[model samples]
Target: MNRTLIITGKGKVSATPDIVYIRFPILVNDVHYATAVKGLDGIVASLRNCITTNGINKNELKTSDFRVNTQTKWNDNTKEYEFSKFEAHHDLLLQLPFDTELINNTTNDIVKLERNIEFQISFGVKDSTIYKQLLIENAISDAKKSAAIIAHASDIKLKEILNINYSFSEITFRSDLNYSYDSCLMETNEKIMPDLNPDAIDVNESITITWRIEN
Candidate 1:
């Protein structure tokens, strides 16, 4: 029989979000389909103009969804169905480089549209490839430190690494506990509620390693 020992270690590193994502939905409704489509086109044009004037790169702005729907209404007195109206809906997603001032200015400008809008904001690392590389290095360093500590306690030297396993914990954005706002206001504002506390986001990773012992 052979005797073996297993050790586990954890590492965490975090940095302020260097990128931002904004999602907004625009809705246009009218009695006639053509009118609704025209209204939607005008709104989209206005939004594009606002974004370009404010220095937001045109390539970063994109349409996420476009949909059209019709509604029917029932007349109680006549006991008949009546065609209500048709509406066009569009969802726009904007990817912005990390610039706090730009974000604030753009959001403020867009709010002037005053159309039916809903918004959501998220933050992330600017270069995901680099961030992932750093995470892996930290995990390995932590695993080595743990192994050394165990070897010292056991009064033995580590011979070789038998196996290494790594996993990353969930990564999530932190927001205010209870804060809600309409899309119009959200798009036009640069600062977000909860104030973006860096500590709130904790990036954790676990490493499980098996090391051979020198007898």
Candidate 2:
């Protein structure tokens, strides 16, 4: 029977985020379907203009979950459900460079475009492939060192690497947009800046190495 030793080592690399992701939505509601659709179109147009004026790339803007649906409310007085209104949602995602001033400026400008807009912010590294490779290498080195120490203590020789398994874990940043806002138009002068103190994101890699033990 062949004897083998298995060791698991973890390595982490801390790096500053080079990209910032900002996500928000414009919600429109009206008693009439046509009115709601028209309002949504106007709001989207205003938002696009705001993005462009801020010098943000058009390709960075993405719209999702654009839907129009009916809402029903319970009418206690009439003892029946009544069609309240049509609700439409336009979800927008923006990817920009990790400049604090630019993010704050763009966010402030975009918020001025509509009152029904709500948002969440997150930070991330634009290119993580290089960092990922470095972390894995460090993990492998750690595993080999550990195995060598254990073998030396046990008076055994490590012949060769039989197998290696590795995995990576990263942190995700997000906030749920479930707050209530007054249904009114936002004034252009009112600035909305959220405190965005981004810390170094840690990229962790864990590796398990199997080595054959020889006498």
State TM-scores per candidate. 0.70, 0.81
Candidate 2 yields a Cα-based lDDT of: 0.76
Give residue 112's error in model 2 in angstroms: 2.6
Off by over 4 Å in 1: 29-39, 67-88, 114-116, 167-201
RMSD of each: 4.8, 3.8
Backbone collision count in every prediction?
A: 4, 0
lDDT of 1 by residue, 1-215 (tens): 44556777776666666667777777888899989988888877887788898987766779999988998899999999888999789888887875767776776677655554456666666555555566677877888898788889888888778888875655453322222347645544444433432333346677788888865
The candidate maximizing TM-score is 2
**For each candidate, what is the lDDT?**
0.70, 0.76
Badly placed stretches (over 4 Å) of model 2 are 75-82, 114-116, 167-188
Give the Å shift of residue 37 in candidate 2: 3.0
